[model samples]
Target: MADQLIDSEIIQRITKKKKQLDSIRPLSKSALQKLKERFAVEWTYNSNAIEGNTLTLNETRLVIERGLTVKGKSLREHFEATNHKTAIECLEGLARIKEPLTEENVKKMHAIILRSINDTEAGIYRNVRVRILGAVFTPPDPVKISRLISELFKWLNSAKMHPVELAALAHYKLVRIHPFSDGNGRVSRLLMNLILMRCGFPPAVVLNTDRKKYYDRLKKADRGNESPFADLMAQAVERSLDLYLEALEPVKPGEEKELIPLRDAAKGMPYSPDYLSLLARQGKLGAIKISRNWVISKDDLKKYVEKKKSKS
Candidate 1:
């Protein structure tokens, strides 16, 4: 009961924050474009990395941006990054139409994920039964894969659960089914974000740093526990919402100043991010807190530098 109450509280908080975010709808075009690009690289890197892709985040960005391959990474790694980007674009199209989740849509995405890598298995159901290493649950039989997927889509359409819960459940159920020969995890994550995007939430990235927790939560869900997985999804959505809301905060006309993160503000300056953060924390810099990060205006950094020069 205590855990249930806590989960309820968290759901309420997520809903409240989501509502606040929706109130600021239609984020400025530039900010929206930047957020989309940023999330695309991040989502691709983390999703592929969680599956053991060796490309660093910077390397992933380079491949996506410059179409340049890294020297040390495998060809498959590069394809994974590009393929996942294509999958995100496909998700965006579905979200625009508010399309209901379907097995065909899922297969289309799985095909994109495996494109140029495994032509035969791409977008097709598995004929051989396989086990997810380290998972507590085994996926359904090969013969039942289509049926299970159809049932999942049916439930998704009729279920009236909260959007976060629905997204988590969609991911969890797909993983349980493991319908495809490969790319199941990647496709499942795509489906999760598809549900979220259609429901007006930003894509919730399950960071590679949290790979262990992510797997553990899925395992817990396998054991008939949904709280951990649901909590994880809610937190992911909330983090994205906070980021979007912060980036999209409108500027007032009379204000001649704006705030930027310490790292961005420190660019081309002698000060490093850590040094700037220290100054902000010490109140020696004209900076303000937004969420857990500190932001400073260009003018404020200039003033701080001038004041230091005079003292010297």
Candidate 2:
């Protein structure tokens, strides 16, 4: 359980591969714009899924514009409700963590994820031992789950790892522990983004498109070869960062006059602060900035807004 045993070779390989990939795959401004559009659609789709309504990209866009929720009466129904609640809870958890990771914060995050779940010890560390990939990966026994988790948190603190890297590691570790009986995948992904968001990065999306690659890499990591998973995660992080930078590209001054600050625009709107912050951080804040404080021109804001609207 020593940090050295975690294996740094994978980490080194990932670092090298990331550099090579960055050299060959420079993200253009246009590609970033496309990513932003895709992200907005994806966010809505995922959010809708949390609400029990499986949505296509177009449907997700519509749901975002016109609020809709699925009405079901089964586990799926409960999942939808809990999923939406869990998403919001996850965002809130991100807001609570500060600077280096802390044991208290990790426990709080676990609690947020299991808030309404029916687990025997909802929000608490696992008491019974668990296995992964059919192997007795052996987490600390139930009696030791809490202390072990705390130790893990301490290790995370000592690593002083970058938020993106920490998020990736946390995801792998949390899944490996399988602390909860259900909702582990969703919770782990949420925890990953919580760490990323705390580090000022946009949330990383694990697309169904790359699900196989994701699983394969995770399996490799579980077998004590962390490089493949680390590299895969790094690619996801790079993709997210590229899209983020693209969204933030400055607009031509004086292009659009009617653009208002998102908070001001959302004064009576139902959008959450987390959502608004994402917009601002990603450079989609034209609609959120006050008109008087508009840094970019009216025409530019108009153009950007129109482009975004058109895609929606």
Candidate 3:
């Protein structure tokens, strides 16, 4: 359904990077373990925070890794942190076995997300109409939810498109369905990453920092355009690829495509730092934002210039 909505450039980059990651075959064991641990923690923290969980990243680490309840936080918030970690473990299991995601998996993911928080309504769909507070669209009537979900799974079964596109659309479809009253957003993101992992891609994290952009993209999708959201997902996927490759596949000395601050990266380049930063923010350039600063690899800078040159 979303074969054409994603930016071709981003898709091509993912394709290239996926091939690169694949060529390395098995990643170093220790590095892979450490990376997975870090992602599991970051993923849990960001996903829960987006849902209003008050635990900071370090506190989330303590809760999940150290099994300590954070002070000044509610029991439900603690459960959210731990529950999300368990749900991610499930996704990792599914990814390892290469299991096809079923309708049951969807419910199970939601259930795990809502465990200890709302036991009764954990996996069950709402029986009444509901509206997202800031969303531009209303979820389908509760009666239609089952049928809508049925259709969604049918698409999941037979859809033929880029995995990244398919994953992004799946997330959008679930969020639009709003299958469960409370944990719909969390489940949608989990499902998205599950699809990616099953397809041999790293789990793409939708950072809590980008929650507003995330929702804005969804709202735009509601307005008959899926590109913005799909693009957002593609960028997330690319970021993870960079993360994994940096940790697992080091380049030969003096040839590393190391990421540098945009200002330093632009010192001798044709594009000014501000101009390149604009492009990066717009998703036209491959870059990663660290805290408040944006960084781009020299290779990505050259790639951007080559593409623009050809277009011009």
Candidate 4:
């Protein structure tokens, strides 16, 4: 049964391969192009959603480009508003978790995620009791939730576990506790990405595109089967890393003389060509002028892109 829950060897292999690949994989041009495109779309969508705008893809793009603020719509008007809140909460939750997780941090994340919702205690753990999938999962009685969470953080601090594996475990444990009445799924995933970002990895956005697979994997993990969940998470991580690498093409050995084209530099960027040119003029970028064309370094463009992202 334990073997069925988690494949120890597979876990080991994933950890080993992740480390090895991190060291050897060089950024490829094609991958970088695809990554930039995806990131442009994702950032537009996510930032709008975070700011309480429930927008479709087209609307999101327009909003990002035109600087339009969503107005007159209640928070509930957004598509899957509750879920969006959950996702946003997840991202914000991660940003605030200090290294070496703590009882305070867990509660802090829970509180932030559940702020406006009416859940028994709102942000507090259930004092009564509850069950999940017919299994009675209870929070620590009264004050014990804090203590148990503290201990969990302590274990996380001391364990020699790979950060990714630790992320997976944290997700499982968080859901098992069912700390909040709602938003546990979002919180768990947010917690997962929090660990990932802290470990120098990019954020993994789990789109609603694979809702069925997502829930099914979670159910399987609940039944003492972890591989399905682990595999799903691994794929998500790989996708995120692939996109990130594609966005930021690492400088290769002896390639400094090969100038990056302006069109290519702005390939995945969300800003306009005119805006990019202005940025270059401000000494914010290293650009090359051609016959009626301008090119900037991928690195320089990335900084401008990030600056826009920060403002959004």
Candidate 5:
């Protein structure tokens, strides 16, 4: 089952990329801090947005950093952004210590995520039976949650696997447990990145635009096909690794890293923008999604071409 959940090609690619990034360890503090700020915003905005938050990425930034309330958003949306930011901070603190993921840690994050939004339900498992809106599998009854979570930790502690695979499956297991009444997805993702960050990978931001596919992949895992969900999370970790490598690597003045949408990135290339988009979505190309548009640097495009040619 772990083999089915570990797409070898994607997992190998992620392992290779992470090793490449690790070679340049001890990055400058400024560069690291800048990436932290950027990713924190992207991470908070996209995670909340997947759950139907109305704030735009920039609006989320304003709420977290500038503390400015946006014109048209609800107070709950504002709290979601700020609370996620706080939870990220707390998560980072936990990452610094190499402790096993525990029930207390999970509850702490759930509490931060639901703070001010659902005070009564924050950090607490649901007493009432619940149903996911579009899920294929029913969540276990309220009484089963605590035992299931404990069992998950037992498996997590003893399972032998790569960190990326471990992180993604850990996410799936938590979602399967549906431990909390609210904030389950948010807490799952937070736990996902906590696993990754503890293992030295940057936080993987699952884009809001990828929400449909994201849920679809999870549902596939629910049906006992874990490969798609594993690939999805592997691609996310790969994307984050690419981001950290790009930001931490220095460039000459005349050769600054430039990110253009796939349309512009495809010019003079043999691949069409659609082809490139497919590659990007499949994690074969190093690209970033800006809002709904996928963008890549000229250098990365070149690398993709070179890598493909070599494989051929």
Candidate 6:
């Protein structure tokens, strides 16, 4: 089916990069620390913003890094940033040991997400029925939440799909169950990335700018069209992989052709990364593949630009 094909394709791409990453296994401690810190800020900001938290990205960083409260933000907003960072730390620890996803783990993460914001609802399933604003689908009854969640974990354990697909599907499944009174979205995303990181992949961050599209994909999954959502998660994973691989790649000496990812190759150009990728795939821009990732030399990109200008 469509889902199957997407899953296979994404798995192949991830598998290829994972192999290359393994060749550079055991990234330097400082590099790992730097990447984690950056992602913590970005992930915390985006996740909280999608949930309508008022802290700006910079404010979230200041609050988390400096422990200094924002002038106009509520106490809850500060707590959200701090708590999410704590949850991310927990996630990093779990990933180090290759921890399996479990209900208790989910609860622990949800608890951190809601700590000081809603203590009563933290880490606990709701006892009352509720409606998600603007959502077309209705969650199951509160009485059925435990059973539904148990079933989801069962599926997660037994499913043989790619990690990207499994992560996306798990996220949608949790969202549909709406097991918690609050923090379901944040918890679901945390759980999704937990699976991805455990599978030796980077965390897939759903940016705040894609909030509308994020919900729209969930809607599609709710309507029995899960492929688009899977594809979206795959792209997110690809971006994270791109980031890690680019940072970890060694700098080559001299004018000798040093191949870099399209993202790096497109720097200083008007073209977006996606556009550069498209051109590469279309053969308009000369690029080579390193384990399914597009890599182009600076000279190649310059030549391509010159060729395009000549055409114009």
The number of the candidate with the highest lDDT is 3
- Across residues 1-312, which tens digit of lDDT does each residue of candidate 1 receive? 233511664566567658867887766889899999999998999999999999988899999978998997888899999999999998999998855768889999999999999999999999999999898688889999878888999999998778888888899899899998789899999999999999999998887876898898889888999878877777677667756766786645653246688889899988888988887654456455544577766756786788788989
Candidate 5: misplaced stretches above 4 Å?
1-4, 252-259, 297-300, 303-312
Q: Please, what is the TM-score per model?
A: 0.79, 0.57, 0.95, 0.56, 0.92, 0.81
Residue 85, candidate 2: alpha-carbon lDDT: 47
**In model 6, which regions exceed 4 Å deviation?**
1-11, 252-312
Better of 4 and 5 by lDDT: 5
Ranked candidates, highest lDDT first: 3, 5, 1, 6, 4, 2
TM-score of 1: 0.79
Superposition error at 98 for model 1 (Å):
2.6
Instruction: Tell me the alpha-carbon RMSD of every candidate.
Output: 9.0, 14.5, 1.6, 14.3, 2.4, 6.1
* Order by TM-score, highest first: 3, 5, 6, 1, 2, 4
lDDT of 5 at 80: 96
Which parts of model 1 are misplaced by more than 4 Å?
Answer: 1-6, 251-312
Question: What is the alpha-carbon lDDT of model 2 when measured against the actual structure?
Answer: 0.54
- Residues 1-312 of candidate 5 have per-residue lDDT tens digits of 345566666666678768878887888899999999999999999999999998988899999999999998899999999999999999999999976778889999999999999999999988988778799698899899989999988888778888888889999999888988778999999999999999999999888888999989988998898878888888788778767877886665765356778888899999888888888877667677767788777877887788779999
Count of clashing residue pairs in every prediction:
0, 20, 0, 2, 0, 0
Q: Lowest summed lDDT over 10 consecutive residues: which window, candidate 4?
A: 1-10
**Shift in Å, residue 45, candidate 6:** 0.3
Model 4, 1-312: lDDT tens per residue? 233333453344345435644665564667755554454456435433433446765555444345454566444333333333444445545556665666555565556555555435545766655555434334445455556666667776786656666777788777766766655665676677777766756555555444456567777776777767765565455445534533454547744323466666666677667777775533344343422355544644565567678989
Better of 1 and 6 by lDDT: 1
Q: Write the per-residue lDDT of candidate 3 for residues 26-105, one digit (tens) a residue.
A: 88899999989999998888888888888999999999999998778999999999999999998888777755568889
Minimal lDDT window, size 10, model 1: 1-10
TM-score of 6: 0.81
